[model samples]
Target: MPLPTPPPTLLRDAALFLDFDGTLVPIADRPDAITIAPGLLPLLERLQAALAGRLTLVSGRAAADVRRWIAPLEVAVAGSHGLELGTKTAPRSAALEEGLRHLRGLQAEHAGVLLEEKPLGAALHYREAPGAEDACRAAVTRVALSTGMEVQPGKMVFEIKPADGDKGTAIQTLMQRPDHAGHRPVFIGDDLTDEHGFAVVRDLGGSGILVGEERDTAATHRLRDVAEVHRWLNDACEEMS
Candidate 1:
């Protein structure tokens, strides 16, 4: 479905939380294959300034990885689906280590399965081998069960992390901080894992923007693709300026 027409006025007082992959940049077959847009850094910098540093990137990727990908333009990030919050590193867990080992073993067995290690978790990506999705899911599920970790499914990926953390918890924690307190939230994302974020923002009397095809979503609005997201964001910046 097409996105609703852009709003006339931007919410300068709102706190912004954006998902990186598929929302900020298009999803790549390989996690490392993604390319950031040429002017994204400047745009985010402007947006962050306008919002009083309330802009944050909330992604399933590691916070360190996110920072490296968007280097030289520092911004708050919640990585590992919120397991690693802000600049603080997640504490090492035996469950995570064991899960990683299990996933690595699966990666060796499956031709196209890739294991992405995180500070507190791991992800099994099977985008290159769609046919192996079932096997990958099963392998991750088995590991999650044995290691007492949570299984988070996203676009062609399965992540195993501690059961306590999620995007909602991350956003809520940020909202309580001095920089974000009392501000309305506006989260935009493009994956099922982001549903928790959407629900949290709405419950806080904010809004959620969904990107890509229509489905059962918690988002209040929709944008067709990454380009539309950029257009909407640019328009919002212009309006506020």
Candidate 2:
């Protein structure tokens, strides 16, 4: 009773969507501390070409942030939990300005809580302060309600984003492009925010590949970690070649 490998045949007509962070690179103590492997850019370039420009990186980080990390590649990217795609960045709610002040207050109380400011929203990472999870979630929930945003919970993090923006809408939007149209979707991600993309791929008659240990997920396939993802992409690229 182990997870089955995804059929290589699916790559034949796939419009690939990838998640950054825990999928492309390992999660870091600080958001900016991740180390991108030297070969990652080349691998993505190869895969993007093999897929005929249908590969897109959908990430929770802002578009500029993601681009800055993977510079010179120039591939399609959906950032800010899909709130920012290409050159478009979603606007933050007016309340977020005041919300940030409140979050700053919370950060002062907890020594290790990391507060990340994005174009559309903000996130509180409590990885360094495990005991602050409940307080962080509560504070973020309050901010979300006041800002007309939604609370998005991920691994040891809580975020507030525009209520309408999500990875599902991001993938669906990209699928309408001429190069992406008619191609089945195959999204790979790890975290609660990715469930939106997972559900969308299933609805589109494609699939989702989850990275990390198994849980109740919409993704049909499980890849143990980022290394497996690299291997899978290498195999897919070779198959296409």
Candidate 3:
């Protein structure tokens, strides 16, 4: 199916939501292995200025981590699948601690499986151990169920997070804020975890742009890859200017 073309002058009044890893930068085997593209920070600064600070990053990474990656430029961010909102940190719980321990043990047992700890959750990455998907999923799922955490599956990763909220709730919450309120929302992301954000934007009379390959998606438009995303964003910034 063909995606609809985005309006030429959408950025002036749009609330933009971006996903981090796969959408803004290419996914790496290890999360820390990824690097931000040159000139990307300046582009985002311009975009945020163009959008009147309504631009936000919604990602599975911690907000602090995202800030660290894009140092010297601060923007609103919802991290840990919306477990942490803005600068407010997600509270740690015994369940999350226990889940992390279990995940760490699982990572130790499986070669090439990497464990990423978050403020409110943990993730098991199997990018280097493609054959261990079943085992990783099973292990995460078991721990999540036992600890009453939510299980989120993404491209080559399985995450155990709090069941309290998701990307949809994150976008919705941002929409109600003074800065984002009354603006049209446009969310762009890749991965199943982003589907919730897409649905929320569509429900709010906004649109979603899917990055990367075609799949079952709620996004109305598509960009081929990170390069295309940067191009489209640059165009939007230009339009606003």
Candidate 4:
């Protein structure tokens, strides 16, 4: 499919929020296979400078994972679906440790599923064994029922993350920062998890860009894939110069 061209208004935005997997890096078979291109950090750094520190990366992975892939970039990062938040300069808080510990402890009881401990939460991946879907769901459901954490279902993965910490709150928090205070927000993502974020940006008088072929999204715009998002981002950054 051809990439959708971004609207001219996108280039004039003040704040930019991006997703990591399937946005910055292409999706891979194993979540760990996704590689951050060598140039991605430099590209984002240039964009950050152009956007005046109004750029942030929000993802389900741990903030450390994001940082490892795109190291030494001073952009704000919200990891574990916003349960672990941090700026470039400040050390990340460990408030989610209890939740992480609880989720990690469930792995022994849940069979045929793998548990990944994230910065602020945990994820149970059942993609490799489709036959274990029910077990996976049951495991995650059991965990959610026991703990107050919300279950965020994604492509073959169920994450037990903080209910209150979402992309919307992350956006609001990022916007409140001094550099992003006056900027109009622009959020771009490609999952059901991103719907609330789209609504938040819309409510804030900004816009959301959905990256997929799905219809009826809360996003104001839709692009085809990660490459399209990158192309549009490059164009936006260039236009801002």
lDDT of 1 by residue, 90-149 (tens): 566676677677788889988888999888778899998888899889988988898788
Candidate 2: segments with Cα more than 4 A from true spot: none
- Badly placed stretches (over 4 Å) of model 3 are 87-91
Q: Write the per-residue lDDT of candidate 4 for residues 1-241, one digit (tens) a residue.
A: 4334568558475798898887788876567778777778888998888877778888878888888877677778888776567744233235445445554665555554567766446787776666666766666676666666678987778887767779889888878878778789988888777887898988998988888776676788888888877778877777888
Least accurate stretch of 10 residues (summed lDDT) in model 1? 1-10
Q: How accurate locally, in lDDT, is each candidate?
A: 0.87, 0.90, 0.88, 0.75
lDDT of 2 by residue, 1-241 (tens): 5566676565777899999989999999889899999989999999888898898999999888899999989888888998787676546556889999999899999989999999888999999999999999999999988988889999989999888869999999989999888999999999999999999999989899999998888899888999988888888888888
| Superposition TM-score, candidate 2 onto the true structure | 0.96
Model 4 TM-score? 0.86
- Evaluated against the true structure, the overall lDDT of model 2 is 0.90
Model 4 spans with C-alpha error above 4 angstroms: 1-5, 87-112
The order of the candidates by lDDT, greatest first, is 2, 3, 1, 4
In candidate 3, what are the lDDT values of residues 37-63, reduced to their tens digit?
997999999988888888899999988
Judge candidate 3 against the unseen true structure and give its global Cα lDDT, from 0 to 1.
Answer: 0.88
lDDT (Cα, 0-100) at 111 in candidate 4: 58
